[model samples]
Target: MAGKIRVLDPDVVVKIAGGEVIERPASVVKELVENSLDAGARKITVEVEAGGRRLIRVSDDGCGMSQEDAVMAFQRHATSKIRTAEDLYRITTLGFRGEALPSIASVSHVELLTREHDSDVGTKVVVEGGVITQLSSVGCPAGTIVTVRNLFYNVPARLKFMRSPASEFNYITEMLIKFILAHTDVSFTLRHDGKDVLCYSSEATGGDLRSAVAVVWGSDTASELIPIELSTPKVRISGLTSKPSLTKSSRSHQVVILNGRFIKHQGIALAITHAYQKTILPNRHPVCVLRIDIDPQLVDVNVHPTKAEVKFANEAEIQRLVVEAIELALGRTIVVPTIALKPQPKPATVKALKRAEDAFGKLLRSKLQIGTEQTAQTDLTASKTHAVTSAENVVMVTTPETKPSEKHVGIGISGGELVDWHEILMSLHPVAQLHKTYILAEAPNGFCIISQHRAHERIIYESLCQKETRAKAVQWLVTPITLNVGQAEVNFVVEHLEAFSSVGFEIEHFGGGTLVVRSIPAIMVNQPYAQILRDIISELMLEQQMRTLEELIDALRASVACKSAIKAGEVLSIAEMEQLLSDLSKTEKPFICPHGQPVALTITDEELRRHFER
Candidate 1:
């Protein structure tokens, strides 16, 4: 056989290259728009029909090309950006590969009309299936306009894979939004089916990122955005990040513009996420429009034809920069989310609830039993001053088993109720907090014990969902605390005092690099403020990089749920136990803590009889 790798046919080579560069109508729009931007276009207009499968037209008021250059632009690997090996390493322009036009023309009928800045008439060139069909001189505007008709006319396989018209149009709109965000100075207009679908006017924005954000996202998003600006010797990072209260369910709203082109870099994305991990609620992503301007020579954009991804010379440093900028902005802002009534999650289906009720139905056949062991330190006395009398208690009562189909009231959503635990727990009369670690109460189904720490954790986390959550809830300490620490720690606390203030610590600069704490978080009112403040400051010092203040604050708040929780061995009065039970009942998840630990357990009469062999 002839040499197996003999030169392939030109048409086959063209198809192979086109497949890599042009995947869909959105790909065509991205390439064409980038080309217009590279030409220094002040104002550009894009028109599409049938989601760019039938036609696509891009017109730009840029310095048009000469007659000779207009024809040469169609040739493969021909570009004005770079010509040598060294230039390839530092490609600056977006279309330096020079394959967009040739690949696009190879499958579609394309017409190019252009005129130079000083030329009297423009040049018109027609291309079909990568061949020159006609050429003429015509009177036209002092700019370039390219018309592409019937995309994938010769490539039926590619056309077959195109998405629905609306889906394809959405892809194009998203691409245009990225461009609009990155290039605020240049006006852009996108027309679909001859109707103006999206437009960004240049005169109104004055090249502001907020204006771009308002146009792409709504004005509400723009107003909530906090500006991020950080400049190093080799890196410049700028963007608009949402406040702690503003978050989204998906990362679709996040974009990173690197070196004038929007791209996907995993390290950069992770950096942004890591910064916001504790700042926003779990599973919620912050709306980000990060722009990284770095030296072009340090980036390798030649990894792919589409340039959707890039390789950075020093990715770690870039990630650090991203984190610091985000953290600095967040540290100065309050971190409570929008608070509303926290509705209880949907309960198990009726069948599922029945199964559970049936599994524990053995209790109904057993007699009411009361344990005499009081070693757990739970006082079972009637306290008239506590508002909970012994007569109102369910500990010694004979309660009929609730039918699985009976309607029960809950503290959460309207017309919604829990099946078992909620019904039993809310009817509980507070006996005492057991050993100061567990809570003992007289439930309708005998008695139940609750883990004090775990119950309080659920209460704290659920409070974040309800009204007046974590923002500015202050508890003035009876005595001001004066903490002595290393100078660096003191300086860090002083410099980032807003971080402490936002989390509800009213601290003032005490003389000689010490801080005087006058107030503490409402949640930590029972805890020792001096020790906790020391621990908070000490933990902050261990962080080598600039972690988001909110991240650190979140860690502290989470720890508060544990360290500040009612200890197991500590004693609880009847009144405190009553209040704790009431607060626990109000939470969406009264049975589980934020860490998935069980908060409460029912001591059924059946189980008690089995222990005593009654």
Candidate 2:
């Protein structure tokens, strides 16, 4: 015998249904704001306490609901945005499912006060946990004000999973940024815990999108953005995108608005990123606010509960338009290369300077003997052993001694015999630079190719990890750079000021969102400090904000190495290439770069013979 299935209680069913529409405090804010927008509200005010867990109040100047409709607004499946079944296919409003008001009312205590412009009296309705507790006529302005309190009180499970107040506030702030940018014509004011955090007046008759973007992303970032505009037979795309010079470490700043509604469409995101593939570095995302206007019939907005995702009829067409618009906009904008600061000599103590001079003498003497091109090939080939196909032929060398005056000039030998390998990598004469990027060298067996940038990056990254190397003398700036940033970014930079100092950057707050960079790492003096500092800060804010001091130093070190390393197109002399290889061989992890890219590869003689059909 099987147990009989029973229907859930009416109260339990409503609460369960509410969970689908309202997952967190940010969801509640999103739904309410969209409703206000749909009501044709030109002016709106949003206030929250305890990150919307304690109270949320939204006031709008749109036309208020009538007495009869006010009572029906909380009932399931009731809505004013749609009338017939066919209306679902073409949703022009930000919300049309009619699930927001009722679902929200089911999970919290709701108070609604409203009045019509022609009516003398208004209606006030109070609801708690899906029950109508009170209703009456009242005197009020010709608008609507909905206040929600004790969210998720009826469902303890949901309340238990709510994030911290600060985390919740960040999410609410991010959601509002999207809405504010999407509907620039509507004025919005947001208050948290009695303090006004964000305020945006309604745009003028013809307002630039840069003004709106500046309100959230700071004016510095907005000024660097380029306007993207494109029109097709069936679509019109217009927005602002950051120039290739201004990229972000994360995709958080990219906003996509479709048909005046904020959405998260992956196809559109991919198109925007693809446009920047050749301009920006790998793993970095561009910042853009793209608005796509397509016929309502060609899109389905009801696919997701939150309506953040939409299904396009022809996604490929939309993608093509987006890519073309961004590419065209970028082609018109000029991107000048950043100029590096003047090079400066590194300061050293008396004893260290004496030892360095001795090391230079030793290096010069060894170079004179082994660096001759003819001697290099003959001596290297003489050390080659027979049967190169044996696995033991690949010999591993020990990490080079770091003593300044120490030198290993003789070929590595075991049992008084000339082995097939040498300890010093500089002994293998570098043949030439391959396209000015890779160091091509002839080893005892076959050939070794090393990526100059990746090799140098690994060396600098390991150097920053050691105490001796980090005692790195600093190069003081003659004219300090004063950076002005937003309040959020300012706070982040100030908090991590000490972390910056650990990696050989000297910075001091100059009051009111301004910081002066007084000095930088000695080795990086000739690199572009302005761009490198900003990039490091942005990357730290994105991925390492919560990291420990040690972790932050390591992360910044890797970033500094990449920025200061030799670029691919730049030419390097033979001495510079030899120095790069020698430094690379001394690093802890020499084969791969800090980013996990292979630094060097070796082609054994056996494989070379097989390639020739031996």
How well is each residue in 1-614 modelled by candidate 2, as lDDT tens digits?
87799899998999988999999888888998888888888888889899899998888988888989999999898898899989988889988878888999999999999888789999999999878999999999888999999999999999888866645665677788788889988888888899887777765523457887777667777888999999988899999998898887677778999988989988988998999999998878888999999889999998988888989988999999999999999999988887547443343332233343322233222221111222222232233222324433234332234221122222231222333332335446688999878888877666778788887887777766778656543556767777655434554566667878987788888764467788777556545676678777766665633357777777778887787676687676676666666656555556667776777666656566778974
Segments of candidate 2 deviating more than 4 angstroms: 3-24, 48-57, 66-71, 102-168, 203-206, 225-234, 242-253, 273-287, 323-436, 440-449, 467-524, 536-554, 591-614
Candidate 1, superposed: residue stretches over 4 Å from native? 1-6, 335-614
Question: Model 1 reaches what TM-score against the true structure?
Answer: 0.58
- Which ten contiguous residues of candidate 1 have the minimum total lDDT? 363-372
Best by the TM-score measure = 2
Q: After superposition, how far is residue 269 of candidate 2 from its true place, in Å?
A: 3.4
Q: In model 2, what is the error at residue 200, expressed in angstroms?
A: 2.0
Cα displacement (Å) at residue 133, model 1: 0.3
Error of 1 at 328 (Å): 1.1
Candidate 1 at residue 79, lDDT? Answer: 82
